[model samples]
Target chain A: MIKTKIWVIVISLILTVSAALSVIIFTLPKKNVVAIYSDGELLREIDLSEVAEPYTFKVEHGDGFNEILVERGRIRVSFADCPDRCCVNYGWYYGGASPVVCIPHKLVIKAVNSQKDDFDVVTG
Target chain B: MKTKRIALDAVLTALALSVFIIEQQIPLPIPVPGVKLGLSNVVTLFALFAVSPLDALLILSLRIGIGNVFAGSVTGLIFSAAGGLLCYVTELILYKFLTDRQIWVCGVFGAIAHGVGQIFAAVGVSATAEIFIYLPVLILCGIVTGALTGSLAQVSVIKLKKVFPFLPFRRKKEEKQN
Candidate 1:
């Protein structure tokens, strides 16, 4: 009986926390081309809207990680030496609910818009 | 006692590893990565109660090591190893407080702890806090799966002791009367 109650409490807590988190994550400001940092150094500024030509860049940062991405209109991480390979599988997420993530390598390619709209990727 | 326990642990680890591998072949409907049913945990729970704590640890380590190879991803291994270790530690703590019949509580806490560990790993690896958005969904899944696996472990233990009257957990102590 106690165990059941504990489970109930735990489930409710997780549900409550998850619901609040979803609201925060969804309502939080969003941006396209918010900011780009490589190896703790700012790389060339990215203009998501004006991207017309496809290009690839090599990013080796804190860890000796190799990353290659084919970015044209929509930026995508085409390849990475990271073992997880989640980012590679995420495949060109231009705009969506969540960011394309590669856990093994702390690399995030976010969609940003310069025109201040409803969401500001980061609450600045 | 030590050698017999080691042999038993080795066998249990091999069985759990096989289950872990077989489970991977069954794909998930959720697109999110690193989520699993972890049915192999049933065996781990059994080892925890039926065998010694060290034996259970051995089985868990072996399962995580071999299971990752079959999953074909090093990332999964990292997530599993960290999560599994955290869960095992929590289970050990809970096992002391809860009776054998109440093992389900241990399971629930272990599952939540596992989720927390995975999220911690995800945040560290991805370098993006935005991934935190998935936590709610993952937590719900964890509860459901954790409860299911916990119940499965409970039923297995109840039934096994019935069939194997000679099981160590039920063995009668030898008397030293004159």
Candidate 2:
């Protein structure tokens, strides 16, 4: 049987590595393009850098909807009808690796590197 | 013996459910979804070490199923079920390798598996592979919270065994043979 000290050291190593990785990922450079997805389908793609005016739009999925607010360089779910309101609480998406997600509504807003736009061209 | 086992399972299920409900009310500062203290897991951990693995599994399933009915959404159920299932399996496997004193190790790894399972469910439901970005932060949160809850389970198992020696704890049986 492995000793308890061995288990402690192993788990501590994992904990430290993940903590360092999280810091690195969070601090990585921000992107300019953001994609809005509902039920895996791309609903809208906005280049945050190009937004001249702030606006709010509603994306409805069945009985629920997310009110998304977009400013010049950031986007956020300003309101959501979902029970948890996790998306709205997520505050804003400013082109980070992490995407704002609402599991209930199957909605996700994520940053996309503009260069990759050619691969998955947005469809009307 | 069967009746005693059933009664114990029911009580542990209730305890897990109550913890699940109360945990929902405590607002977490982090806005990221699928992140919580998961204190209810303490009961499951205790059950796994002190009680039988079968008892642990029963209590976990009941807590996930009924707990969702009371305070969760349909989608929430899917996430909880996925996470709980993965976490239980991880703990079950680890249980054999570690002694009772090392239950905390099970907690840490089990919590990490739970995070991974939740991420898979989230990606599948949303159809967004980018959701993987949350993996690192989720794992980080899992380590911290898992350690806390695991230690809680370790202490509970030790103390509760002393207080209620009649309960069918696996450790008690092992001690008798030794």
Candidate 3:
């Protein structure tokens, strides 16, 4: 019991430090992607590049997961019906590192980039 | 002790698998992606004390294998095996020093260990550190669920001694049954 308590305290401290360190290390702003979100009532868009006007996607809002295509420039989750709005987490539509994920609504906006044809991981 | 050990462990493993399958159907209020109560671990705790360590390992493997198959996710098999292996190893190590009264702590640690193992598997599958963001949440869930499962296992250990007194309590009865 004494040993177990000691182990717990030590492990707890180690876990805390690692978790905090990871958060600090990974919050860097990623620049090469665009993310989008909208309700049937409102549409919001952001672009990877600081341009005068980003390309617009066409779509109508309904009570389900909705996707709007940004063509060759960039892509975003046009809209979703679910509440958590995880589609926003999937930051952009063109990189291997980030896949736009919508956790609450179970919607995803996948980025299709023509530059790289090879994928490093196959999630089986 | 040798032959009876095999049979008892087999039964406990099957029981754990049944509990795992049943618990899968009862949805949780919070829809965190991979969290679970692990109620089936009660059978594991029982087998740990009542049977030999080798027998306990067999039960753990069987329970994990059967649970994954029943849940219909072959992808989950790696996580189940890794998590189960870590939990079983931790429980065995904890039992060496702690008494049955201290089983709750073992349960807590087992849960954390299981979460760590699962995350390791997830990192491989997801291929992104973004998935690691959920580790703390998973660990908290592990501690909570581990304590619950541990308490239930403790109660079952006590009750089984009374109901099946001869099976668990008596050396003579064990010999005769064997």
Candidate 4:
């Protein structure tokens, strides 16, 4: 009896929170910048909107590196030495609540606005 | 008694490993990080009831340890280990108050704990509390997936007990029933 009540309450609560999360994650505006992070440190941030020339750079980490290929308004880890290469599979960053997390190398590539970045307070 | 326990745990560990690996092959319908069906938890849930909580913990740890080797990532192991330990510990505690039919409750709570643990790891590793943004989403997925895996485990325990009446775990259940 109590267990059933617990299930009902827990499920309802999760559903409510999930709905809210999805709304927030999906509705985020396309950001103009993306910050690449390795082992909790901000490696670099590219202003996608300001990229006059598409370029590629190797982001070296302790374990390995991710070859980040950037274009005018998008970014992606086109190559990496990590075993899974799931980060490279992330393809391109448009806009979403979820970032491109490179699990093996502990790198996170996330979309953000130039006005406000998530990594700003890290070093401070 | 020790041999029986070892044999059963080995089998359960294998069951969980295959489930974990195969589930990975099936691409997720959604692109959410730290979100998956978590179907392998079904086996852990089954073992939690079919054996003892201690045995369940052992099997879960073994599965996570070996599963990560199959996953081929060092860091992935850390994440899964955090999530797996949290889920196992949460369900082990919840099992006491939970009736056999209320197994899904264990799942719901276990999944929340799993997500919360992984998020803490993510936040610490990424050195950004902003990663907390994924918490609500992972928890939301945890509830749905945990319930599904929990219900499967409940049905499994009932059917498994009947098939293996000599099972030490089933003997305990019968003793309680009588």
Which candidate comes out best when scored by TM-score? 2
TM-score of each: 0.63, 0.71, 0.61, 0.68
Instruction: Please identify which of the two predictions, 2 or 4, would achieve the higher lDDT against the true structure.
Output: 2
Compose the digit string of candidate 4's lDDT tens values, residues B112-173: 88988888888777786867777878888888888898999989887888888776663334
lDDT of 3 by residue, A2-119 (tens): 5546656855675576557546534633334343433322244444433345555544445455555454445666555557655644444664434565554434443323223257
Q: How do the candidates rank by TM-score, highest first? A: 2, 4, 1, 3
TM-score, B chain alone, candidates in order = 0.85, 0.94, 0.86, 0.92
Give the top-scoring candidate (lDDT): 2
Q: How displaced is residue B8 in candidate 4, in Å?
A: 0.9
CA lDDT scores, all candidates in order? 0.68, 0.86, 0.64, 0.80
| Model 3 per-residue lDDT tens digits across residues B67-109 | 8988889778888887888888999888776555556667777
Runs of candidate 3 exceeding 4 Å displacement: A1-124, B1-3, B162-165, B168-178
Which portions of model 2 show Cα errors greater than 4 Å? A29-46, A49-124, B172-178
For model 3 chain B, give the 10-residue run with minimal summed lDDT: B169-178
Predicted complex 3: DockQ: 0.10
Q: Write candidate 2's Cα lDDT for B1-178 as tens digits.
A: 7888899999999999999999998888875678989898899999999989999999999999999999759988999999999999999999988776777888888888888899999999989788788898889899889999999998898888889999877773343110
**Model 1 chain B: worst 10 consecutive residues (lDDT sum):** B169-178
**What stretches of model 4 exceed 4 Å from their correct place?**
A34-124, B170-178
Which lDDT value does model 1 have at B100? 57
**CA-RMSD of model 3:** 12.3
lDDT of 1 by residue, B1-178 (tens): 5566666777788889988888888888975555778687788877876665777888999899888987888888888888888889988887665555656666766776677778878888868886666676666666667777777776776677678655454322322321
* Two-chain DockQ for each candidate model: 0.21, 0.34, 0.10, 0.25
